[model samples]
Each structure stands twice: as C-alpha cells, then as structure tokens.
Target: MKPALKHFFDSMGAYFGRPGEESLEQLYAEHPGWDAQRGRVAVYGDFVRGHVRGVLEKIFPLVRGAVGPEAWSALVEGYTLTRPARHHELNHLAESFPAFVADAAASRGLAAFVPALARFEWTDFAVFASEERAPERVERLTANPTLAVLEHPFQLCAYVRTKGARAEPEAGEELALLWRHPELLVTYYVEATPSALLVLKMAVEGLAVPEVAAATGMPEAELRGAVERYSRDGLVLAPGGGHG
Candidate 1:
C-alpha cells in the first residue's frame, strides 16, 4: 500500500509475478530474509519470472543448451536484465532480441555462434503477426481494394548465411528476407545477394513481377526468374494458390 513498497512491488511484478508490491508481500512473505527495503530483488523475480524469461530462454536455448545449467543461468541473467521487453504480447516480443544479440555479441560477448543462431530463431514467430506481409492476396493485383485493407506494418528481421558452403557466421550485417505467409508461417533464409534479397522481399510483400522488376532495375524475364526461385524455395507463391 505504501509508495516505496508499491514501487518495489511493481518493479518486482515486472520481473516477478504480481500486480504490485502488495502482491509481492502476500506471495513472497515466506521467502528468506524478506524485508521492506529489499522487497523483491532481481534474484527473487527470477525464481518466479514467467513469460518473458521463458521466451528468451527458448530463443537462446541452443546457447544455453550447449553451455549447460550454471553458465546458462548467468547468460539468462544478462539477457533478462539488459533486454527487458515492455510489450504485453510475449509471442512476438523477441523483435528486439536480435539487436540485443548484436550489442551483446559486440560488448558483453556471447557464446560463439550465438549471435547468428539467436537472430535466426528470434524472428521465427514474428513473421506471422507482422504487418509487412499482406493478408489475403489481392484477387486482382492491379485493381484497387473496395474495402481499403491496409498492408500490415512490417517487422525488420535478420538472418544468417553459410560462407563457402558451410555454417560460417556472417562477417557483417547479414542480409535476410523474413515475411509472414497467408498460413502465418514465418520463414527465414540467407540471401544469396543484395539483389536476391531485395527481389525476394518484394515478392513476399505481394509485389507483382512488373512492379518489383521496375523498382529493382531488373528485366521482367529476370524478375520472373527470381520469383520462380522464391517459389521453388517455398518463400512466395502463385496468387491463386493457397495461402501459407
């Protein structure tokens, strides 16, 4: 009920499991050495922390799984404290984790292959809920929509590619194409080239061959070739074809 205690609880709730400090007192009263000043500290929250921690843990499981328990806990501590998500929806919350990996991989340091592996896994669920991919392909690619459906807001995601035909980490910012299909399947793949990435992107965004070709400075025949490549890869599909 008190502000200091309330503040402590809300902070705890962010990391723990409660609506506020009052809840913390009620829930964690039996814990060792619990007091007014240290109502619910980081360690306490970790014991009770749920959704966000669970999601991040899944993302970095390979990193964690490879390292085992003690080391993984330490890694998780770094991620939860440093890269907290404010959004209520946990499924698509790892949008920032890729960027966080970039920072940690550079500064705090991560297990080798972590940055690439994390980026690949991070965007897996997001493509479905993302705004970039159009919902229900246009019956007529050229005609205007009568109901005025808005193309979804896009999510910027990254992917990894093998170097020299092996799982070599990208030396720099890797070019990737991530988009949701009508079936809500989020797919990721390494872009062969910048042009290839851009062309594939345009294809997934529901751009027609001509528009994409004009925008990308490729010949229609070439664009068709690229679209077919995307189709072969199962990244994009024919208009009248089934969604997803």
Candidate 2:
C-alpha cells in the first residue's frame, strides 16, 4: 500500500504484464538504477510467470496437451499478461482461463475444440472443489448439488482419458454430466444421452419423475426407469427408505 512499494509492483507489471520492446525502458525510466537491476527484475518476472503457468498447467493438463508445448506456453503467457491475478488463492488463477481460451482460440487460429476442452477441464476442477453436498434422501427427485451439465462439441471424456495420444479429438456434439461423488468426494463425469440430460435438467429444478414425464412428454414408466438409474449412480439423490 506504500507509494514506493506500489511503484515497484507497477514497474514490475510493465515488464511482465505488458508486451513489446519498451517495457524495460518504461521500468528504467520509472526508477533510476533499475537498468542495473534489469537482470534481477527479469528473473523475478520469470519466477512469477512460472507460478502462473504451473497452476494453469495443473488445472488444464488436457488443454496443454492438446495445444502442444509451444502454443501452450504462448497461451499461458498471454493469459498471464491479460488476466492478472485477482484472487488470493493460487488455484483461483484459472477462474477466467476458459474464457481467455475462448478468445485466444479464435484470434490465435487454434482448433475449434480448444475452448470446449478448456471449459470441460475447468468444470471438472470446479466440481471437485465444490462445497455442495448431496442430501441423503429426496422427497421429490433432486439432482446432486454439485452436478454440472456441460454440452461440449467433442467427446471430451474420452479425449481427456486418451491423454493426448490422439492428436485431435473426435468431433461431435455431446452432453457431459459432471459431478462430485457424494461418498468419495471426487469428481466424475459421464457422457449423457439427450433424454437422460433432459430428465436430469428437469430434476435439478425439483421435478418429480411424473412431472418430468408429463412436461417432456416421455412415458412415465421410461422416466421412472431413467430416474432409478440416475439415483443409483448418485446423479440424483435417492429416497430415504430406498429408491422407491
């Protein structure tokens, strides 16, 4: 908060946060003798940028693998310069990264799937970190509190599983159901069918099976079967006594 400290940080930001040739000159002009300390300032910038890239790499390993190292590094640097740290927690650094990737993918001429992949990866991390819990029982059908429905343009689940062995993903419009396991407290996902997604989306709004069937025009028997399957998989909170 002191003026001197604030000036130092601002100078550092100019060096790392801004691109082009004049950053160092601006830093040197701001504080005399910083020219002598350019090496130290460069090292400090590398250290901070390293931490940002490391956290993003951990959060979006799939995105990194898909884009390859050169593009990944450039993307990370772009993210660092554009989306400066806003949160106290390091993990929160990635909160805006998916949106960043969306813009970068377009301007940088990256693959179409890149944005979807980034979103999928971030959603996985978010579901893992969610504080919401599934109730033991539901009077009406209820979705898991941590459940997130993601509709992606590629087979993200399988693509992430392959770990980038495949150069590109299989292209298709798909729905993925991401949630934290109530008992294990780990994130899990399943590619879902349109009907199943519809049921779960309705259930998230507190619709009972019958109500969902009526609203969607699905047969009650079929809706009940789907509800039972979802309940067994912990996508829907089950009834107290049983899934009756």
Candidate 3:
C-alpha cells in the first residue's frame, strides 16, 4: 500500500479500536497529516462498539444483571477497548470473556462466584452449539462427547435458573455436569455426585467400569450400575443393551 493510504487506514484503526470522544481526539492529534471525514468515521466506530456490546450482553445477560447497569456499561466498554472482536462470526467473540471477567473481578468488586458463573454460561452455549455427536453404541462405557464437568465454589445451577434474581450465589462447593441433550438439542445440567463424576471422568480417560472399580476400591457391580443409570440419561454411552 502507498504510504498515504496506509497511514489513513492505520489512523482509522486506532480511532475505531476504542470508543468515546477521547479516543477520537487522540487519533486526530496523532495523525494530523490525514484529514478523513470525522463524522462519517465516528458513526461507523459507534456502530462497531455498539454491536460488540449488544452481542456480549446477549451472551452474558446474567453477568450484566449481576453487575448492574453502570458497572455493566463500563465493563463492556473496557472489554471492547481491550479485546476487540476479531472473529468473522460474532458468536465466537466472547470466547475469552470468562478469563477477562476473572481478571477484572477483584478490581470491579464483583462477587467471587462471577467468573465461574461466566464460564458456566459460556460452556452452556458452546455445548448447545457444538457440531459433535455421541456415538450410537459402544462396546464399553463411554463419556458423552458433549459432557462438561464444572466445579465451582457457588451454586451456579440455581443461580442461572433464577435469571439473576439470585444475584448473590449461595456459598458452597459444587460439582455439576453439563451436556447437550442428544434428542432435545438443548443444554442440561445436574448436580453431580462424586461417584457419578468419577465414573464419567474415568470413561473419558478410557477406563472401563471394572478398571475404575479396581482403582477406586469400589465393587465392579456398583460401578456398573452407576454407568447404566447415567447411560439412561445419555451421560454415558454404553453398549446397545446397556442404554435404558
């Protein structure tokens, strides 16, 4: 590209990468050589920022509600300025948002559980949108392709169900399993027992029920029963006769 054209595009990039009049003024001061149409350019910048904020709000509505209006506004603006969306599709834009939220949580006075909540919400959306499919049958126990094991310090399942009415999560250590419903094509989560999580985890690690029983010192029949129960819910993909 010619120097003049390259400079113009570079200046516009700096301006559009951040929202607010302050960023615009900085751009003008830094790029005095270029005289782009300020008003027309500002409109486009505003649209990009607005669209990014709107998509994030839709994806993390509970996070917005928990933070309240003023904080939520600042949060989205800060996120846009720091991590501009780069994906061709906006659906993947918030892929790093949970980590971003975790980094900002303490400084923003957000509750301890907020980061985990964000992760759970993202996982829920991801699993629902995933193209992966569970196999029709397996010779042995197998973990569902869409299974997600979530462990956090809050009762996030109930909190999400309340739609932020339960803004403050009840304090507790919780482990939950989330997955896409094979037939229903929706996300579902259930509080997991240690045995249930262990069974699935072992299956994912390519261990059969007998191996898990031997390693954990549990009876093989008991472990097999657990696998059969989970198979009924499609959490475990067992053989043809194993699925209830």
TM-score of each: 0.54, 0.77, 0.78
Candidate 2 yields a Cα-based lDDT of: 0.79
Please identify model 2 stretches exceeding 4 Å from their true place. 1-9, 18-28, 32-44, 205-225, 241-244
Write one digit per residue (lDDT tens) for candidate 3, span 1-244.
9997887667666666687789888877877765878887688888777778878887898988888899888778767766456677787777788888899999998878889988988888898888888776677677788988899999888888788796498989998888886666788788898877887887778787676788889998888788777776777776674322
lDDT for model 1, please.
0.51
lDDT of each: 0.51, 0.79, 0.80
Model 3's C-alpha root-mean-square deviation from the true structure amounts to 3.8
Candidate 2 vs candidate 3, TM-score winner: 3
Candidate 3 similarity to native, TM-score: 0.78
Sort the predicted structures by TM-score, highest score first: 3, 2, 1
lDDT of candidate 2 over 122-146, digit per residue (tens): 9999999987867766676677889
- Candidate 3: global Cα-lDDT? 0.80
Candidate 2 minimal-lDDT segment of 10 residues: 235-244
When 1 and 3 are scored with TM-score, the better candidate is 3
Q: How well is each residue in 26-47 modelled by candidate 1, as lDDT tens digits?
A: 5545444555455445445544
Ranking by lDDT: 3, 2, 1
